[model samples]
Target: MSGRQTSFLAQALQQGAGALRSRQFDLAERIAGDILKSNRTDRNAVLILAHALVGQDRAGEAIAPLERIARRSDDGEVETLLGALLCKSGRAADGIAQLRRTIARRPPYLPSFQELAGQLSKAGQLGEAISVIESGLALVPESVDLKVDLGRLLHESNEFAKALEVLTIARDAAPGRPDVLIELGRVLILSGDYTAAADAFRHVLAQRPDDGSVRAYLATCLLEQGERDAGEAALRAVMRGGPHLLGRAAFVMAASSHGRFFFDMSEATKFLGGKST
Candidate 1:
């Protein structure tokens, strides 16, 4: 292509990218399609088109164009996205295979590992999912996201100690990350360290005070630790969060009644009887 053509392609790609960021999927799709018509092999145009299709909930349609890019180049990111799209389209086996191939290349692409691990987990291959995450951690030792996944998987597999250890490292690496803290809090709860779990949840609440789910978890930790007044107070606060939190609050109340400390039934009835707040 001439310099002018190259410049035009660049400008079009920029506009398409901006449209995608703004969630103008139809506009982005049009721009990407026009660019592809001029140069069928344009990688950015193909990616933009795929993203636009996905944004519009047409993930299956995005797969073929991504595969077209995959055939021309060994782009691991594209392969990862293709694999994920295939899974989203109900082709899990094919997607898993593609993701495995992408990871086997060891191309420093973190999403390949994450997507493969997630698929394996959904398929009930927890061991393989854990292995995939561990492999990714080996490749990217400093990746807090990988560590968080490892921690969560470990917790699911009943390896609470290891999960706590991994999440602690992740927390140290990224102290204020809500995801890391949430996973850590869960592991702590499993480990029967209610105090530590409460601390973790508290940190997250400090950052996201309006998060009803976290508030409920914090109430659980408080109740499990036998802090009745505080736990009840927290539960009431959760109830006040609105109708969305009612079920969780009730669940916490019921759970506390059978946990380390029994919640008084009368108090539960009294609390549930009132309007929220």
Candidate 2:
């Protein structure tokens, strides 16, 4: 392209990006479409259009534009995104294949591994999901996100010991990370170590004081340890935190070892009021 044409395209890309950042999906889509009309293979234009479509809840429509770029470009990020969009558009097998190809081509690209493992897990291929994450860790040993994911996958597979070990490494690598702490807390709970679980949850609460879900988990740990009074107080506090917190607290309660179920505030109130539902 000539200097003037290149300059024009650059300006148009800038405008589209600004529109996207400002959440003006319609304007961004229009700007990207105008750029693509001049050069359909333009990477920036394709990405902008894809993002705009996704922002408008038209994710499936973004797939064709992304695929157009993928055909001409070996860009790992683009292909990884295309793979995710394909999965979201109900083409999981094709998406998984695309992600595997991307990872084979760009082994160090983290998103390909993450996306592939996520898709595999969702497809009930849990073993492969674990292997994919382990392979990613081999390539990027210092990736906290990969470690956290591996830990979660192991936990889901009922490999609590392995999950706890992986999460411990992740916690050490990323001290004060809320996600790592939260996962560690959950693994500890499932491992039948309520004290350690409560400690882990406390660390997360120290970081996120208003987190009712963490509070609920902490209460479960306390109750498991026979600290009924403290646990009840925490549950009551979560109940008073409005509907969202109350629902989350109830979910945690039902999922934990206590096996309690609370459908609404009134039910929760009745249980804590000594009716013990």
Candidate 3:
């Protein structure tokens, strides 16, 4: 291509990137495809195309384009995307290996570590996930993202005290972050500290009052504390708000009542009054 054609291609690639920034995935894909047709080796275009596919929920389609560029380029970031896409497509083992490779090859990309840990968590490898997150935290101690992941994995692994401690650190790091507060509330509930759990959930509700899930969680805390009236009211509020009942209302109750018993059961039964949902 002449200098003029190369210049045009660069300009077009920039436009494609702009489309991605604006979340115009279809247009970005088309422009990226146009650039690649003229120059198949255009790394930026391939990356943009892959991002566009991912934006459109086509992570499976994104794998090939990203892999193509990843093989030819030493860009650790692009390789991270390939690994993330692989994980999204259910290739957990491959994704984890590729992500580890990406993390090992170049600068410590925080996202790659987080994504790897999340994939490990989903695979029920909570120990591995905790290790990966702790590794990330060692690299960037103040990273709220890594801390949250660590806390969640600890909670999922049934280490409620450890989860609460980690999440408290996260909350202290970002005092007003709702997500950290929410995680704190969850762990508190698991540890049978319903009062503190309710406070945490209520703090979140103060910031986002209409969050039905949080309201439901508050209800759980109340019910678990033997405050049946307050818990019932919270559950009723959720039924009036939306369709969710797990965090919105029924999960804890069902657990306490046994079997499929929930809000639908008689109010005078066990968990509430004794009922089935």
Superior by TM-score: candidate 1 or candidate 3: 1
lDDT by residue (164-187, candidate 2, tens digit) is: 999999998888899999999999
lDDT of 3 at 247: 44
Off by over 4 Å in 1: 1-8, 257-277
Per-model TM values vs. the true structure: 0.87, 0.85, 0.79
For candidate 2, what is the total of clashing residue pairs? 0
lDDT of 3 by residue, 79-138 (tens): 888888898898977888998987675457888888888888888888988998898888
lDDT of each: 0.87, 0.87, 0.81
Give all candidate RMSDs, comma-separated: 3.4, 3.6, 4.8
User: What tens-digit string does per-residue lDDT give for candidate 1 at 1-277?
Assistant: 7999889889999999999999999999999999988777788998899999999999999887889889998899899999999999999989999999999884578888999999999999999999999999898899999999999888889988899999999999999899999999988887888898899999999999988889889989988878877887887788777766666777787777433222564455357543533
Candidate numbers, best TM-score first, in rank order? 1, 2, 3
Q: Which consecutive 10 residues in model 1 have the weakest lDDT in total?
A: 257-266
Q: What TM-score number comes out for model 3?
A: 0.79
Better of 1 and 3 by lDDT: 1
Better of 2 and 3 by lDDT: 2
